[model samples]
Target: MSVLNGISVSVGPVLFKAACPDCRSRFELAAGALRLAIGGSRRTTFYSFTCPECGSAVRKPAGERIVELLTGGGVRTLRLHSTV
Candidate 1:
């Protein structure tokens, strides 16, 4: 536990479980290892990560639950804006 600005702050690494479709490998990834993109629609909303087992880049559609978990876990987020 640490104190910042006179407030108690607890920090820890956040891990998320992910599966790679190409390699069929399942593993846990730290929040820093994941990227979440929220777009205007479900079709555009997704998350991506590099597979540790096969070293392949994996992308998957993120539903409401997924979005909630990833965001709550402190994963980096990118908001997508449409050109139109």
Candidate 2:
């Protein structure tokens, strides 16, 4: 079990509903299948998932709300630092 935002969630193999825009195929994916990145700029911050049906990579913008949900859902997240 895991606690997210103070809410207890079952930590076992949980499936999340995902859709492939390219092939229009809908499927379920585990938390490990998704990746989230928090970047310094809006354009750099996004979430990624692979489409099992078409093998296409999908990336979507991760706004504040999306970030919260993704993190709470146990998706592995990475912090991006700008080296300048």
Candidate 3:
């Protein structure tokens, strides 16, 4: 792992490795690559990402521990407000 001209090359476990389900391309992404949304309901709390290789939108449910790790790791986050 090396940083070339400010670009990181997976120096450590700090960066997450994701696999695109559509294209099957594996790549390393920083916490910035993920987005977390916390909502009024437990079912609404989750994380989202776009697969760089296939351009497919991917969303996964985030549990309590996941939310903690993601937030601690610097992942961008949004809070959802219910109109009802």
Tens-place lDDT per residue, model 3, 1-84, is 788999987655567667777888989878988999998778999988899888999888889988898898889899999887
Question: For model 2, what is the C-alpha lDDT against the true structure?
Answer: 0.90
Clashing pairs in 1: none
TM-score of each: 0.85, 0.78, 0.73
Model 2 spans with C-alpha error above 4 angstroms = 1-13
Where in model 3 is the C-alpha error above 4 Å? 1-13
Please tell me which model should have the higher lDDT, number 1 or number 3.
1
lDDT of 1 by residue, 5-76 (tens): 999999888889899999899899999999999999999999999999999999999999999999999999
Which tens-of-lDDT digit does each residue in 1-84 have in candidate 2?
879999998857757787888999999998899999999988999999999989999988889998888888899999999898
User: Which of the numbered candidates is closest to the native, going by highest TM-score?
Assistant: 1
